[model samples]
Target: MTTASPAPELSLRDKPGFSDLQGVTVEHGLNTQDMVVNIGPQHPSTHGVLRLVTTINGEIVKDMEPVIGYLHRSKEKMAEGRSYFQYQPTIDRVEYLSSFYDHYVYVTAIEALADLKVPKRVEYIRMICMELNRITSHLLWFGTFLLDLGATSPFFYAFREREAIFKLFEDITGARMMYNYFRFGGVNADAPPGWLDDVRKVINELPFRFDEYEAIANKNPIVMDRCIGVGVTSYQDLLDYGVTGPSMRACGVAQDMRKTNPYSCYNEVEFDVPTATEGDVYARYKVRMAEMRESIRIVHQLLDNMPGGDSAELRKLEKEHAKVAEEIAAAKKRVTVAKKNEEAPNAADVAKMAEKAPELPFDYRTTGQKVNLMVFKPPAGEAFSMVESPRGMLGCYLVSDGTPKAYRVKWRGASFSNLTILPSMMIGNLYPDLMAIFGSLDIILPEVDR
Candidate 1:
């Protein structure tokens, strides 16, 4: 009693969802039991904090279940407390890889509630940013997925191409990844002079880099062996679980949001939705690769036909500007007199500025007209907006109860549904192929647990 007896040799054994291996007897008098393995809330290939509680017998997986919510930031709940303007920054945390899509859906939801009219140029800019964001996301996926499959060089190669595009994003948005650029009616700011030229330059260069990527990895034996015919998902399986994006397209159903349900000037451009009938790891890989090329094609079309006024329209706007200049001078004089008398600018003084302000062509008006952001509110209504994110259909559902803050916000993240089919797919497969199948879905945990 005094010696403590070595703490009774503590062993964590025989728990639910797990059992000690020593308890089972095989036909040849060998003892065996299914082993439970925890893959991670920190595994490198999971792409975020995602855990797989798997039960394996020998080298084959008998059951696999995803334990999510590790990376949940409570984005929907956060929106309920914060004002619309205050909440924009946090949307980046929900889906950091292709965050433009998040902004697009969220902002469009608000725009619909308020019935805001966005300019054509703003639509074009948003589309360009979104499409480029897709390329960057897919490129990063292409890199990491191959790296997950035991190839190292493609990681560096894909990122090299991605860095050039990130520089373009940095120049425009000030922040590289978390860009709070989109506003309700339009973008936060205009594209600077020569920005379009820079975009044209980079997009022109990407195809060759893609060709180089294809040459190296498209038909590589190790990649092909690991990818083709593995983790097959049918089109009906996608529908049953609400899967979309490349995974859905890989099953030969063309369900791209850009094509099927046009948004943000996607209807103005023409691009084919790339598809494959196999619905396996190789098919998903092919679909994403093809989508990158298609995104580039869309960027070119959008840039080539950027919305702007003709020379005649420019001349007409200039004439209007000259007329406003005279009115503005008179208005400024009234303001000066009021200031000298130590009086605040009255309603007439405020109206004078508004009356004098020239109406710029929508093409030149990069951002929306001024609206008070500090205490903004939308009409009492509900809206559901969706965008085709790199992973799948990302939807934002908003309810406005005629208050400055939202009544509710709901995020339909693709990863949540895509991951649902994982356990079913993994049940009978060899254990090592887990990465091959899961990585192909391009599931990011933040998107799932948002």
Candidate 2:
């Protein structure tokens, strides 16, 4: 193998869509040396501001190193001083494409620390929303991956359905993207009237639309030529690197956090975890398509068995419980002051005032029980939380110093690990195959940078 010295500076250009290098060639001969080319940081094909310093011999790749951190946001550090509830919104930005899953994992961690019990109805609702969000996220991946591969029509088609899903989210959460809807013990509120019907319509119509997508893209010879056998990461490689989600599932591993860990109502939901023996870009694509269908199935079940309960009622109950606690504390303080003074206000007066206090409103009784709404204080304990985010396994390690704030928060993002296998997959492949390989890895830069 010939080695070349690194170039001092390289000029990079951004191309709108993918391109195939039909006859382009790097200089190669017995006396010739390899050349270095910088593919991105701005190139549209890298998906999101990723830079690859590639060493090539003729048309074949020799070695490639991925350069990241172009979009770094100090999410973990930002979480340090913020209260657990306050930090939840920040988590939505970590993986912007799949904000609901991000919020779910963060809220679940806080709930675990506080030992809060979520209502059964709330759990089911969360499952429905998250699964819907997962489908929307995968739709985005499908559309963008195709865009990276030079297919424009599929992008539009996929987004049309994705808009429907986003509208559903907006109806429930009042936001399309960064939905900070999940609360500590439950959701911010319940789904609005006809929300179930909207979800049902989407779920009912999705399979046929997916069939249209497959007919248009899956069997296309060009897509197959670009995707098949490209960006292959072996099962052992994925395991060693701690990859998860459909990316790992594409490597023949059936380890889904929803299935293995069974958070929320995933354990009760019936769906198959899709897997592929080949860990190539095409296999990852197939896995995502299968996962979308599974999501539809889960949503269908949720819609069919939609529960009948008032979300406002639950919030009211919680508020009433809090009021009772405050009243009791105030009464205790008054009694303590009376005992400290040898002479004090009349006991009968105090008793009468306490008795005359207005009875808790009946509507307040509907609110879910008010458990302590204090800041999160984990018991000097450490817990590792992982969820099957759209990209892969998103993990958050929390070490609490017996305070409302986390002492240390370490995020183990799947995109970070999945990106590591790129150079290995890139070696020996042609230049255009790099786009195919990178698109197949299905990473979100924000999550990786976080």
**Candidate 1's residue-wise lDDT over 73-125, tens digit each?**
88889999989999999999998999999999999999999988888888888
* Backbone clashes, each candidate: 0, 6
All candidates: TM-score: 0.86, 0.80
**Candidate 2 stretches greater than 4 Å from native:** 1-32, 309-379
Cα lDDT listed for each candidate: 0.87, 0.78
Error of 2 at 173 (Å): 0.9
* Model 1's TM-score against the true structure: 0.86
Could you tell me how far off, in angstroms, the CA of residue 170 lies in candidate 2 after the best superposition?
0.7
Q: Report the C-alpha lDDT of model 2 over 220-284, residue by residue, as the tens digit.
A: 99999888878788888777876677888998989898888888777777899999988888999
Which lDDT value does model 1 have at 138? 99
RMSD of each: 10.4, 10.7
Best by lDDT: 1
